[model samples]
Target: MAGREEQLLAIRIAETLSRAAEAERHYVKIIEGSSSDELEDPNNDDLHDAEELLAHRTRTAFRECQMLAERLHMPDFAKDIRKKLKAYGSDAKLTSLTYSSTAGEQYCPALADAWGFYEPMAAVALGGAVTGLSVLETMLRNTAKIIEQAKTTPDRETQVRDAVFGILDSHSWTRAGKLRLQRALKHTNRT
Candidate 1:
């Protein structure tokens, strides 16, 4: 029989795993539909779709915190969320995370406005696809570890910079390099 602490951890792990599975299915579906041209679309909402997925995941993470607080009878832990969110009041971008997007739909213009580099990023051909998949994998992995272990790991901030460097740090546009990355998507179906 699990103790209360163990039960809380188990619930947190279950919630995290559920969100990861949901995100995987959503992204895998989108990737299956992605053609080379889809990335090139001015309305490329790949990351935006991801944002919606993550917004839900993020909300769930906070909810898990509240769950833990409730189960443990720690009022301060639950109250901290409001204080933390309030701290971001000046930066509306950061503050907006408090609002969850229920629709699970992509708003490309919002994505573009939020990202500012979406269309340009989309034009990177296979580089964009490979990089996006890699980043998502890293993020999901870190998120899992964070929830399961309740430890703060350092790599999340560096993931994007590292991914971009991994994709572009090489020499030139060679057939071999392009082919290598294209091969990474072999398991994926692009229409």
Candidate 2:
């Protein structure tokens, strides 16, 4: 009988393989929807769409295989995936931007204008613009400083930033106050 760790590894491998197979199916569907002759046309929208679909599927497959390789302690296999992705002109390194759209679902004019640049001063300013002016300003300044100075992993930084944003969004600030904060957040690129 397989040991517990072995069993878990096997399960992970199976799941990853399943996802890769599903991605392959989607790739096939995209190819089948477009004729080869049409794909040869430089101005064909279908050709561009097919290329985009294929690239997405390739990236998805690479991620699944790379993850499985890492789980199985196969560093070489992961390296191979990275090489393949590079050959295909895709970035193998993963970041938040890779998996998410630039702007979130709810549109903020300030954020849109700034392309989501964050400024610590915005939060500090928000503190003084509200009813709990002094207290909020002090708290925001402290929190912002902590976030900026903390030596943490990229994922941890993302988590902290998300939490801060959640608090700001959920707080009972006046509409104008919120707008001002959003504008501040967008305008300045200070860390």
Candidate 3:
């Protein structure tokens, strides 16, 4: 039935979005880790270049997936029912990920709790289009804060360990994430 078809499409779109989010998160992690020369190596220009390329590719892929999901009219569902609704003409161009939309707000909190990144409420205020960037900045700020706090606190190592693990565990591996991870790991090993 048409309803069933729509439902399936919606599920597909949701899964795709989830995958894209996971990939984006992973790339952010890699970029954050590589950004510090002292933690890594100041002279490793090639590694930095490769990380930048991977981050660019990941962002492009995430945007494409989001656009495709919106274009497919996959998010249309029936009211109060677990069925897909018929797509109106305008559905194709509609995106739930709009800056002012509820869905956009959801990403901020999820990112904060899962990755220990930016404050969700602050990110939501900045708007969704740049939510990813905002979150990244928040993560960097949090990292700097942690370092500063560690200098004054005796439990700095434990706090840093928890923060790192929070990021790693909150991230779900998608196809793109896996590919990037493999490449990064290989590159790391080679160096």
Candidate 4:
């Protein structure tokens, strides 16, 4: 029975990872498609439309990632991930994650690796965001900081920075990014 339970847990973990991957892919598609557009074109409705779609998809992906992470028993992964992210700096990484292709490729692997390391906090943060918890904004800002840290630091800092970036850049919580922002504002309003 214990062996069976372990197998079940493993299966659940795999499924959650798969879902997170799918979310990342969707985010990638949005990013790739957005960049392919002609920025100089006067009739750039497609770009705008694509941006909107990307935002929507990002949110959906984030919510799903949060759900899956919660299922995997790593509840506080997002929060811890946020803490690690704040250690790095948020703006630099956020710009890179959204704008730089080379940065994306280089940093994405680190971000993904970080996800594995800090899955529990991430899961909790994501869950709180999805469920409309009061703490969502604080979580998002912290996550943004984590992404930044992953980008600019060196050595061990770099490792943690990359992991944080990977988790943010991944499709796992693209949409959650915006939701987190909203939550942050909501949190401010209450205080």
Best by TM-score: 1
Model 3 misplaced regions, further than 4 Å: 36-191
Q: Report the candidate with higher lDDT, 2 versus 3.
A: 2
Name the lDDT of candidate 2: 0.46
* Model 4: per-residue Cα lDDT at residue 42: 49
Each prediction's Cα lDDT score? 0.45, 0.46, 0.40, 0.46
The better candidate by TM-score, 1 or 2, is: 1
Per-residue lDDT of 7-116 in model 3, one digit per residue for the tens? 44434444544554664455445544655654378566654454444334333333333333343343331121111111211222211112327543322222222222
Error of 3 at 49 (Å): 12
lDDT of candidate 1 over 1-191, digit per residue (tens): 22446354544545564564466456546755788787457687874575457455544444554555444455775576445434433322331322227655433222122222112222322232345457647645565444434333445644533443334445354667555655554434353
- Give lDDT tens digits, candidate 2, residues 1-191: 22344345444444444543444345445445667776467887654554454445445545555554565456785676667556545321211012126533222121111111112212322323335555446656776554565543346544665545556666765768766765665565355
Global lDDT of model 3: 0.40
**Candidate 4: C-alpha lDDT:** 0.46
Q: Tell me the number of clashing residue pairs for each predicted model.
A: 0, 0, 0, 27
Candidate 4 residues lying further than 4 Å off, grouped into runs, are 1-43, 78-191
Give each prediction's root-mean-square deviation over alpha carbons.
21.7, 19.7, 22.7, 22.4
Q: TM-score of model 2 relative to the true fold?
A: 0.31
Off by over 4 Å in 1: 1-10, 17-42, 85-191
